[model samples]
Target: MKKLLLSLVLLISFLGNSQILDPVKWKTKVVQKSDTEFELVMDATIDDEWHMYSQFTPDGGALPSVFEYKNTKGNYTLVGKTKESPYKKVFNDIFEVDEYYFAKTAQFKQVIKVTNPKLKEVKVYVEYQACKEQCIQQDKTFTFKLPEIKATEKGEEVIKEEPKEEIVPTEIASNDIDSTSIKTEKVTETKATTETNKTEVSNEPVEEEKKGLWSIFVLAFLGGFAALLTPCVFPMIPMTVSFFTKQSKTKAIGIRNAIIYGFSIIVIYLLLGILVSLIFGADALNALSTNVWFNIIFFVLLIVFAASFLGAFEIMLPNKWANKVDSQADRGGLLGIFFMALALAIVSFSCTGPIVGTLLVQAAAGGSQIGPIVGMFGFSLAIALPFALFAAFPGWMNSLPKSGGWLNTVKVSLGFLELALAFKFLSNADLVLQAHWLEREVFLAIWIVIFGAWAVYLFGKITLPHDSPLSHISVGRLFLALLVSIFTVYLIPGLWGAPLKLISGFPPPMTYSESPNGVGYKNQGIVGATATLPEHAHFSEHGIVAFHDYDKGLAYAKEVGKPVLLDFTGYACVNCRKMEQNVWSKPEILPLLKDEFVLISLYVDAKEELPKEEQYVSPETGKEIVTVGNKWSDFQITRYKNNAQPYYIILDDNGKDLTEQVGYTPDVEEYQAWLDKGLKAFKK
Candidate 1:
């Protein structure tokens, strides 16, 4: 079972990066409180596993949602403050404060008295912070068209129902939200989370997508073959094949039952795959990678499985359930064979369940429904094939290796690997949270210790709780021990940043270490790399001198007679991290960025508050620019005409562009070339 999980992780490490998440939607409606009084109703629809902070956060750790009213000045007089729906509160570990937020939906209301009856509509946008694995502050626009209202001097007249103020619902994109662009209808009726707002999943099969799914299928098939080598399932092949031959009256009937039995196992696993999709919602498998709870839960679950496999205790299905399943195999005919397959599934769950779960995780990471289905289909096919083939020819059972002490050796080895695989999840959570608990050096050290101990155990120096007495180690065991020892030695260099490309994804990125250069590395005042730092300039995580404020960085660039690397990034932006790890760390690019450019990294999601005197309302959005992030974010929108993170633009000493801006360039050579071009132009 532990081996199953180990192989599953090995295969899944090849899966691609995570998807971009836009988790909140917004809409609004206008309500006539009386003839001249109107109320604006705005609601936000949040996606699963994500929550948005309330307008008035009680403890004030997270950025609270704020609203901006546009084009409603002289025509209407302000009523009371905006009232929010009831929200839930929870303590945040990062900020050490309780935060108020809403899951699924959050509603807010604002009432206004129309001094001039000509007020026809209302426009507002909400800026809020939403968090799941990482926090993101984004905006959504809501345009509410007002209905025609008539007021008479005689008395407060009851509004006529014939021409009610109903609004045709519409979704406004963040960048495209303005007064003149959005098309809206004036009716009182309003709707939210409607069909227009639903994010559609394309079931259309692309060639590359199918190829990726097929790769998962093939890898899962190989994993299935590996699972058959485990003690739990390997010994059962002979027992089950013999039972089929004895029960059937004729040889052909036995073969038929065996084939049917094999398919039943496949069906069982396919159901597991389908369950993964259904449980996570229709097709949320794609978005599961960045989920914080999922990583934490998986880490703990795999550790428990590893402990069980290490002979600490047996993790087993309920005895009563197993007994009932075994009893069903006693029934005669086709039903009995199907039950026999079920019996095997129940009995060997300790072995197969972990592998199946690991495979599903791998498939789910692929972000395709077909990957899970086909991957499981391939996995169960591997498990079932040997049973059917051996039943058809009982003589083949003699060729199978007899289960022995070697099986225990394999199990213990896998338990060690299970420990290794478990940390990958924990590391993922740590990276997501920037908790710094398991940096690259710490992680590599842990793996070296784990693999080293396993090698020592394989040499017969240490016997586990279940190991049989052995006078001497087998040649096979000695050879594997040597291999493990060499692999352990190979990992030692990774502590000092050897890239360790062989085990890349298993550990955190090279930059996410104790020393950005390497373990125990220090700058001996390298001329271009290290110098007297200017104001607001500090060594960034990438080991390059960086400034958070744009003006300071630009001034320094002018003084140094170098260009500027304007990085509009966010702390939680996954793409930005990817670029830093894969592109900036390149031998060709890192030095150029360090020496040739004064790098300014303006974090669009930074949580620190700006100076009180510097804060004001944004002229464009009318939202308050309170935080450092808010200032940088508005600056990016106004200056660069872009709000997306991981945005890079090379500028001359005057802070003018030297090259075209790019976002998320994955190709290292292309990015390096871009930097080279920018440098050449600056020099010219």
Candidate 2:
């Protein structure tokens, strides 16, 4: 009898741990509005607390609902894009975009024109994601028979409808009708279907194209300042101004000509910006920021630039091009001034080319149509300012310091900075690909070594190919050396696991580290206070006692009589790391996360393949689930209708919500309050 009772208890536990929750229901129907025109409606009856995303979610947001007509060649033509019922629009913090979703119920409709009289039925394959406490991917194929129409005496088609009392399997409320019934209602465009009648318009202004102009200009201006410190451009300042002072007929003419030269420089760079924009288009350039191949290319390009800056070799324009442009400058007029500007550009190419390339790449990544133009404008303004100002005040030339080895120091320092920055692009690629080779500790170590070498070089302990022999380190050099040495020391603690909040975005996240559990630097504020747990307690990658599987988490929560804190997260989520480091590390919040609630961190992007027996076809999306990520991603969508990471929900052991769902809230006090509220609700 005792053995039987123990076996029964074990069986119940296994069943509870194996339960998988799916929370969405769908129905489809075809409604005849006119004889030739019929509306195909897809209705979703979502479970309570769950929601469905609309088909119009913006780019960089959650996947939108989609409907694909399977067999439309013979009998029907798709009239317009899918139209959806009213949905709630809210700003999603995780993706930093406005997203639309529907709770409880959602209806999508597509108008179809019957092309052949012999048409019998219409078939549609629908795909959507639903979310509440979790998400699930769902797909369904719906078939609806076309209603028969009879020809009258005059050959006009009339509806042969059933009686109103007859029960229809797929009937919708009359008041819940499609807005397409109104003549003025516009159909919402859907990416899933194409409309043949829609006219393509060009030269239209777009919102994304207008963004980041000012930011690009500022960054370009800073790039120009850095260029001004380079060897090729610095010596030219006094020489060019002196020529205007000595060669011109009068001071006024020299000033005027110098201003014209400045304008010419702006025009030249602006034309270059325009050419680049024309070549690639703003959308494609913006997308390059996230493209792995583009990032790898950028990494290699930057490394080459760093090598050049370190005096490995000079990256120069063809001498023939400069000579040709210089020859044009001998004409001696406005055209000559423009050609002179071109000559300056060609001559300074070795020094400024890399800076210009970096600036343009960064600006283009911002996804603004005017980014290149604004960046060029700012860069030109900086290069042009010295020429215009010094030409106006010829006497100021005496105040300038003579150029020497210090300029080389500037170049070498920039090389170090470039080398450091180059790794960031590499790290971005590594993180996106889930290649843990450049983990946080490894990245920090590399940075420390690079900066330490740079500090030694600053103090004249080391020298590059172009560096002059140092008699002694100057006071300024000493100060810079000290600063770099201190910075290198600061980064050392990060290897053992320090938050290093100052350079948080540069390195791979702390969670993606060799010691993610804070093994060595336990005293660091980021390390969570260890808690005693039952022998069966499972922990996350970060060493926090948490469950990676949902059913196991809920079962544990039930056993412990504690509420579950469902953390919908991703491995690559940046804000999620910020929250963990800044807010969750706080005294007020850490205890609750560690002790008060049962933390269940579901990594939506986990790529580990599930066991073959554990994998199954997703009912919602009709895709084979082969990995742990797919299962959790599907769960989040099906339960909560949200696809963004860092989503949090507090639920009782019964899997009911104890508090409202929150996402990526970084404020410590607010998060603590939220946790306290959930705890109170749990107790009640």
Candidate 3:
């Protein structure tokens, strides 16, 4: 029966892949810049299983899709970069992504700055890659010279390119003594634009990030739940309540002690939260976010957490130290009982340490003013719950399960999970700086091997020194082991060039693979072609070079007339996805892309260099513009003065503001209005 079920599942999987193959479709649009200059916008849609590369790949990686104007007499200026709409899919252990496109269409745009406005003919050449299991590289050339149109007397078609020249040069001098003069002018102009644009537009006001009493209550609720499972708290619930019942010689007195015990746990945990807040100060969390060493240290700490779970060693405070507190319970007062609880926490740290570590890490990462307090609330609630419940109903203790080897198993499993979670942070570090080694596939390979070994260990095929002997396994255990083994097998296809669609962009893009090109198709067919080719897409021949630096991209943008599209995104920003899907899809919006804009996506979470010359200290806040993203972020914060995303703006040829900046427009109508405002501003 099991074999039959497996076969049925495999068949369904094959059918899903057979459909949704990448579809190659293309479209174009024309935007008039002047009587002599017109922009050509062509969009290409490749089938589901393929992707085109950017212009800059490191050594041994896929070539950046190349473009050359062909069959043209007009002077054409290359734009900064091509823009792609974002895609989404679940990320998994395979470390690869399936590049999806708009069903049957993709778009590309080119701006032509003609030396002679009267010229009627021009040509374009493009080279790119498209693939399934095998990639077919292709090159195509097309001539798209404009057809003549007679002028209308009423100025209906008397299109005069306003030649609204912008001072956007390929470079800006940071210390151009006139920079101060420019700054004053820039600020005044920005304020005038904002005032003119404000007409009290009607839209639903977004709820601000929640604050006040309810937020605190919610944090407390979550903390209490986490504490319930701690070894120190669960077992002691019945013991403490039973002792109170017997010694006090009355149910009421016992109930009173139990209530007091729960309150003591809360107080102690809250104090810890308070102390952390005092020591770190409110701004420490924000500072840590950008501090590279903190991230590295976190990575190492999680590794230690994983090892401890694997039974490398018990992590606990000294017994004498804990015993000193435990001994205070004999003093017959509320403070003594509270000390006893603290002693229990210290002594049982070996068992409870992972949970505490995880909570603290989460708190630190959240970096909210009340983060520690919220975290402590969750911990104390979990610890306090059982005491209240057991005291209220003494008979329920009979139903509680006794501690056994399964408890140890739970600890080890969590350790494995922590180890896995650690890599995500590492991956974040790698991708932020565009480190190529931690490609999606490589990350997956490590995870698959680790989890596979864990499965084997779970089944007793591999045993830790401290593990309990397994005389025999239950059917349930065998079934779980089988499930994990099958999942591991699923990752193997990725090494041989599978997208592993389950975990798409969450992993590093497959463009980072050792040999991402068609394994057999290398060196034998038309580049970016429809023709079949040899398929051994070897690693040495094809690798993906990661580029995370914005300054570098900006330099490339200037080197190449591509307008820059700034995408201020976060690793955890859900709204970023909403903007990508909801707004970037309209037909009018997609086509106007090339004539007026160069797309530059700046992920706020990315880590990379800021050119030393470009870096500076912000006068307003005195913060260093440390990374490439930081420079852009500083610009966004100081100029627009808003950090919340998804923000959009358009700049002219001189990299000066050509439009009003818009932030977080979720409504389609509002988005269109916002975009239109920018377009008009650019035109003016």
TM-score of 1: 0.66
Evaluate model 3: give its lDDT: 0.53
Q: Pick the candidate with the highest lDDT.
A: 1
Better of 1 and 3 by TM-score: 1
Query: Which run of 10 residues does model 1 get worst, by summed lDDT?
Result: 195-204
Model 3 TM: 0.48
Name the runs in model 3 displaced over 4 angstroms: 1-238, 474-684
Candidate 3, residues 225-343, lDDT tens digits: the string is 53344343456666776766666667777677778877887787788877877787644653343345665777788889889878898787887888778778777667877776677
| Alpha-carbon lDDT of model 1 | 0.72
CA-lDDT, candidates in order: 0.72, 0.71, 0.53
* Every model's TM-score: 0.66, 0.66, 0.48
Question: Per-candidate RMSD vs. true structure?
Answer: 13.0, 10.8, 21.2
